[model samples]
Target: MEPAGRFITFEGIDGAGKSSHIDTLAAAFRRLGETVTVTREPGGTPLAEKIRALLLNDAMDALTESLLVFAGRRDHLRCVIEPALARGEVVLCDRFTDATFAYQGGGRGFDAKVLSILERITQSGIALEPEKMRDPDLTIWFDLPPEMAAARLADARAPDRFESQPAEFFGRVRQGYAERASAAPQRFVRLDAGQPRDAVWSQLTGSLVQRGWLQAGTSDVGASAS
Candidate 1:
């Protein structure tokens, strides 16, 4: 059956295991008989997927890449996310606007003002007001050091452009996420992502219970808090 809640986002850096735990949480939600729509940013919609390739592929310039991300988000919101969210489905996304702030603002040293401008331009046509934009009801930031994250990436597939950046850059991005989370404590739930998988899941579940999102039992963010 279709769900009757809005959205939830899974946030984290490259190797913080956000993807892994998203799977676990989704299954838990299903067991509770809640409908969910699992998706990700930079490519939830068809046009956005192509933009995602351009953004993640190594060839594009940083400015171009960042712009493309906003483009993808614009389309993703209009076509897939907003509709599902309007229907009150639980939208589980892998990443969202926070990634742009972390990667472009912190890692690449881009002015956040630029992002504000892009958001305004891209999202203008959508009927959803600024306050009613498809924001996650809960955001979970899996925290981990960049050094450890880089090591974890080593065993994975070929690195994306962002993943291939210098460790120092990613460290700054991590710091940015922490700062952002602190700035919006009500929306974000910070987690010590360096813990074991089982331990992390335990902490996640506890948060979900605390939030009253999960019925009986379920899974579970940070700034601009989730």
Candidate 2:
């Protein structure tokens, strides 16, 4: 029998280095001869990309913005993520619903009830489809303090609308992430973002290997050991 496709997501606030690490991991997986399909949230498919612009641009109510995000996610899963998973390819996503709980429920002061409603709407349609609604096999949360995340954003181009929120808002976002991870310990793996790049990479590879997602001694080599 073929191995089941894996859906893995890298999650964190803006500037948490998830993008960089995801790139590194994808390359590593390819070097190991693994078939991997990489993508990002808020903008994976065409429709999602347009929705992303609206979410990140200036002047939108928080509720509207959050709902738009879920809408984009629904289209993305239907068009991109679900198909790749059904084909038995590893799916590496830059963000997933965990981000919604963080940025919308925590940062924007929306209730978790709102998230549940949107999730039902977005996921219900595909919940029973072939190879559907398989929650991420692993959600790697690149845990970092709000201050550090803000500092990294500062070094980049002008902060996007979400990145421009007050420091306290981001604090709440972090708390939300913490809450989600706590609730789903089996699916969420927290990585220390305070460490150096190499150190974090080591931990990431190790987690994946321990979860039996990758071989112990492949291109990941020493990376999976540390």
Q: Give the runs in model 2 whose Cα sits over 4 Å from its true position.
A: 1-3, 127-132, 217-226
RMSD of each: 5.0, 3.1
lDDT of 1 by residue, 134-178 (tens): 456788999999888988999999988888888899888998788
Q: Candidate 2, 180: how far from true, in Å?
A: 0.5
lDDT tens readout by residue for model 2, 67-173 = 88988998998898877877778899999899999998999878899787787778654635543344788999999998998888887898888888877988999
Clashes of each: 14, 0
Candidate 1 lDDT score relative to the true structure: 0.78
Residue 178 accuracy (lDDT) in model 2: 96
TM-score of each: 0.89, 0.91
The 10-residue segment of model 2 with minimum total lDDT is 217-226
